[model samples]
Target: MDIDHPLALLGGLTPRRFMKRHWQKKPLLVRRAIEGFASPLARADLLALASKEGVESRAIVRDGERWRVKHGPFSARALPAASRRDWTLLVQGVDLHHPAAHDVLSRFRFVPDARLDDVMISWASDGGGVGPHFDSYDVFLLQAQGRRRWRIGRQRDLSLRDGVPLKILANFEPEEEYVLEPGDMLYLPPRWAHDGVAEGECQTWSIGFRAPARGELVRELLQRVADEAAEETSPLYRDPAQEAVESPAAIPPRLQAFARDAVAAALKDAPLLDRALGEALTEPKSNVWFESSRVPARLRGVLVDAKTRMMHDSRHVFVNGESWRASGRDASLMRRLADRRRLDARELAAASDAARALIRAWCEAGWLHETGESHG
Candidate 1:
């Protein structure tokens, strides 16, 4: 994408301008962000996906002054009647299960893939809603079908209403309101409280970004780095000359220093940390799984699977929770694959023998497919 080129998706602001002005700082409302936009999946299709095992879904129903939430693999008989009011079914990671949904997700690739998360679809009945709440991550809410009335505010009070099944704001004060029609979109930065109520039956697509907390990020990276370090040769602490200590229960100062050095050694390896970060970022969600396939004896082109997560750094290429060292021309080719998600005949032909072998291995792992094959 041309970061300088204006986009209807960002209300005519270029991606560069939008990132500088509104991203994680304020809200943006774009009318007709997608001209004549329609949902990729119909209501019935969404219900079927929600009923499938391994997919994440939830049903929320409002009953007068009370609200209730339920998890799914919901059966067809488990959902509320079509005419029922004040109910919603939320299916997470729709892109992982449907090709059209994956295409819809690809539209937002202007953001880096590492931070871009999956698309979620919310199907709701008349008067349906999940109530006023704030997300810790940024989101673009696009109205796909029918209409929804949204009340929004930059909320200061983050307290939740006790006894509610959902994390609903207790003091939701709307400063602005709008009725979004099909193709309209609203972008909300993290912690911007908003409530959407369906005017009638409706569906909305939410493109959410990941914003891992500092501690969570550190913990994951450290764990990966330490695990890698453990596989390498390292000295064990040896206190051969110990003084007769009066405090047998207390940890020795020398032992503490050795432990500190062990951790420091792991953290000091810059390349290891970088590889770990790339692998962790590209790791698929826990519920995601891929089927193995036989590799073709000959290949002309390839397409990365929608369910596969691939990323690259200067020193390494990572995909599906695994990392490999990459440099020079091979690194460039791998990076291109990560960026474009496909390699045509001409591009594949440019790969060296080793790189071609790696590509075939990825194909056999079901991370990518031969040109004529269907995307996963």
Candidate 2:
């Protein structure tokens, strides 16, 4: 992607311009954004995935004015019939299950991988919808199979309906409305209230980005730091002074100081923080598992698994919840692999022996696949 050139996906604006103009600021609707777009997963294929364990799915049924939501690992027979009106099936993380969906997600690599989440697909019957709601993260709603009419507004009132499973807006005031067809997409920033309803049988693909809450991030990082702290064989806290306290119930101020010192010590390890963050970012989903494989006799190159998360900073290369200190030619090559998600024969040949051995180990662990000239 040329940063200076306008792209149809951005409604004829360059990525830089789009980011400056609309990202986290407003919404953009692009017609024919994916010209002649086709859905990656068919209806039957989607339903099959919904039935599988570990795949997150939901079914929402509209009962006149009231709505009901159900979690899924559903049998097809348990789902509402195709003839049933006003119901929708939503499947999350379609990108993880479908290769084409993953490819579609890669097009948005202009955004950093750390912030990009997975793609979700919603299949709906005529007159179906999940009602008016707002997401706390950025999203691109792409029409895939049929038409979905959308009403959007910059809502000030964030109140939700009482006793509802879905977080639906109680007072939805529409500022504009549009009917989206296949290849048309709408980008909405976080908390921009919007409602979408299927005009007929339709499928919509949503590429959502992650927005980590500050507190959540801090807690996770601290958890990682604390795990490392536990390994320290520090002597137990000792106050040898013979002064006895008058109040037996009083907590010691010296103990509080010791607690602060321990936290200060954790913060003092600068590289530890960086390593923990990298590990956190590359941590796999709870349901994700890699299949073990045998190593080949000779390695030519490697391709990262679609499910693998790989990234690198100045001192460390991170992949699949592990971090490695890299420098010189090896660091440069690994950084390229992180960026491209593949290492060609020439690039692989340039790596040091140790780096090559580590890569081979990862391949055997199923985080990557060894590629050769004849393999393709």
Candidate 3:
């Protein structure tokens, strides 16, 4: 993508301009972000998907001042009827299940894959809503069908209503309001409170970005590094010169020093930390699974699986929670595959013997498939 080129998706702002001006700083509403946009899944299809095992879904029903939340795999009978007012069904990670949803998600390639999360579909009946709430991460709410009235504000008081299953704001102060139609989109920064109520029946597609908390990121990276570093040979704690202390429960100074040194050694490997971070970023969600296949003899082109998460750093390529060392021409090829999500015959033909073998292995592991093959 050309960063300088304007996009209709970003309301005529170039990728660079959009990132600089509005990305995390403020809100931007784009009317007709996707011109003539039609929902990839019909109302019935989305409801059916919500009932399937391994798919994350939720139902929220609002009655007067009360709200009820339910987790799914909901049965067909479990969901409320289309005519039922004040009810909504949300299906998470729609991109992982449908090709059209994946294509819809691919348009946001201007954002780094590490920060890009999955698309979620929310379907609602008349007056349906999850109520006023703020997300911890950025979200692009694209109106897919019908109309929804949105009330938005930059919320400072993060207090929640008591006895509610949802994290709804106790005091929602709306600064701006709009009724979004099909193809319209609203981008909201993290911690911006927003409430949307369906005018009648409606569906909205939320393109959310990952925003890992400092402590959460540190915990994940440390665990990953420690798990790998434990396999390395290291000196055991020795206290040959230690004398008995009066306080038997007190930790030995020498032992504490040894513990610090051990941790320092684990963290000192910059490359290992980098690899761990890359692998963590590309790790698929818990419910994701792949179907294995052998590489075809007459491989022409390859497409990365929709469920596969592939990324690269200066030293390694990470795919589906796994990492491999990459360098020189092969590194370039892998990077291209990650960026474009597919490589044609001409690009594949340029790979060296080692690179070809790696690609074949990826195909056999179901991370990549022959271009014409049917896959999720």
Candidate 4:
């Protein structure tokens, strides 16, 4: 994707310009961003997905002054009828299951895949909404089906309502209001307070980006680093001079320093840190798993399934929850797959034998597929 070229998806502004001018700085409302945009999955289809155990879904309903929240796989009978009002079904990672949803998400490829998260669909009845709140990550809310009225502002007080399942803003101040019709989209950066209430029965697709909190990221990376440290064949403990501590209950100063140094040394290798980060970032959600299958003996072009999430950063390639170090031509090919999500026959043919073998292994593991072939 050309970052400098203007795209209709980015409101006729080049991604480069948008990133420089507005990204994480303010909000942008683009009309007709996706011309003739249609809901990729129908209401029934979305509900069907919500019923699947592997899919992540949530149901929210406003009952007078109170809001009710529930996890799903909710049966259709559990949901209020299509005619019922003030309820919503939210399905996460729609791009992982629906082709059209994936295609819609691919338009934002100008952003790096590592930061890109999955698309989520929210189906709401008239007057339905989760309530006024803010997200910690950036999001592009595109109206896919009916209409939605949005009220937005830069919030100062991020207080939540007491005793509600959703983190609704306690003091919402609206600076601007818009009723988004089909093809209308709104981009919001982290902590920009916004509320969307369905004008009628509506479907909205939120293309969200991942922004891991600093503390959370450090915790996850440290855990990964510790795991790697445990696998090392080096010395575990070294105490050449064992002197009895004056305070029996107290930890010796040397031991405390040694423990800190050990942790620091384990994380001292930049390459290992990078690899761990890549692995952690690309780790799939708990329910995500590839379907195992056999790859044909004859090699062919490879097509990554839209349902699978693949990503790479500086030092490693990540697919599902698995990670691998990429080097040489194989690294290049893996990077290509990370970028394009597919490789043609010519590209595969040009791959080194080791790379081909790796692809074959991935195919067998169901992480990849041979183009133009049925899985079954």
Provide the overall lDDT of each model, using Cα atoms, as 2-decimal numbers: 0.92, 0.89, 0.93, 0.88
Cα lDDT, model 3, residue 331: 90
Candidates' TM-scores? 0.98, 0.96, 0.98, 0.95
User: Per-residue CA lDDT of candidate 1, range 100-120, in tens?
Assistant: 778877878888999899999
lDDT (Cα, tens digit) per residue for candidate 3, span 182-298: 999999999999999999999999999999999999999999998897888877778899997899999988889999998898788899999999999998999998888977786
TM-score comparison, 3 vs 4, better candidate: 3
**Candidate that scores best on lDDT:** 3
Which of the predicted structures, 1 or 4, would earn the higher lDDT when compared with the native? Answer: 1
Better of 1 and 2 by lDDT: 1
Can you list the residue pairs that collide in candidate 2?
none
After superposing candidate 3, which stretches have Cα over 4 Å from the reference? 244-247
Q: What is the C-alpha RMSD of each candidate to the true structure, in Å?
A: 1.1, 1.9, 1.1, 1.8
| lDDT per residue (tens digit) for residues 115-174 in model 4 | 889899999999999999999999999999999999999999999999998999999998
List candidate 2 segments past 4 Å from native. 372-376
Error of 4 at 358 (Å): 0.3
Candidate 2 per-residue lDDT, tens place, 203-238, comes to: 999999988898988888899999887887876899
Instruction: Output the worst ten-in-a-row residue range by lDDT, candidate 1.
Output: 99-108
